[model samples]
Target: MYTSFFLLSSRWSLPMMMSISHRGTGVAMSLGVSLFGLSALVLPGHFADYLDLIRSLSLGPVLIYSAKFALAFPLSFHTWNGIRHLAWDMGKGFKIPQVYQSGVLVLVLTVLSSVGIAAM
Candidate 1:
């Protein structure tokens, strides 16, 4: 079963993979943001206190930047893919070639925007 699953997944085309990724990232971002907001509401300290706690860890700049990139990537991907989805909803870009082209465009835009946000 596992072998078959892996084989099937490996055979996914770019658009298929991007569609799956869009749903996965949407779920992840929703959960992450919800948990974060809930934590802020229930935590015993101000937001700056948590910020200070993280700062106290003294993690290196590289690690911090990597963390930022990790967080930004899903958000960027979801946002771009969502735009694609909206276009699809409007009866646009339904052709196979157009679908593939839009998928690639979304990926490129996602990467660029994610990196830009992470750099800050």
Candidate 2:
């Protein structure tokens, strides 16, 4: 029996994936920035104090890496997505093929940017 659910589809269509990534990154970036600002304002002591607190934990390598990823991912995604949006604003990449290509470009740029930020 043929049905809508039986149809094969591009499971990872470029536009679909990019749209979700855009929202995810936007929310993540907002939360990250807000939390960072809040921590600076609400923490009992200065930035060094928070650093000492984290340092005291003696976190394992995995934990450190996860923290780095969490911090880097949103910033990278938002930056890339913002660029994509700017292109749209300039009346570029409106076609489906160009949109998909640009999405790939955005992902690549985001990964590179994130890696660079994490390495810093």
Computed on alpha carbons, the lDDT of every model, listed in order, comes to 0.94, 0.82
- Each model's TM-score? 0.87, 0.77
Candidate 1: tens digits of C-alpha lDDT, residues 9-72: 8867998889789889989999999999999999998999989999999999999999999999
Stretches of model 1 off by over 4 angstroms after superposition: 1-10
* Per-residue alpha-carbon lDDT of candidate 2 for residues 10-113, written as tens digits (9 for 90 to 100): 26677877788888878877887899998888878789977898999999977887778778877788788888999999999899889988888888888887
Runs off by more than 4 Å, candidate 2: 1-12, 60-62
lDDT of 1: 0.94
Q: Name the best candidate (by lDDT).
A: 1
* TM-score result, candidate 1: 0.87
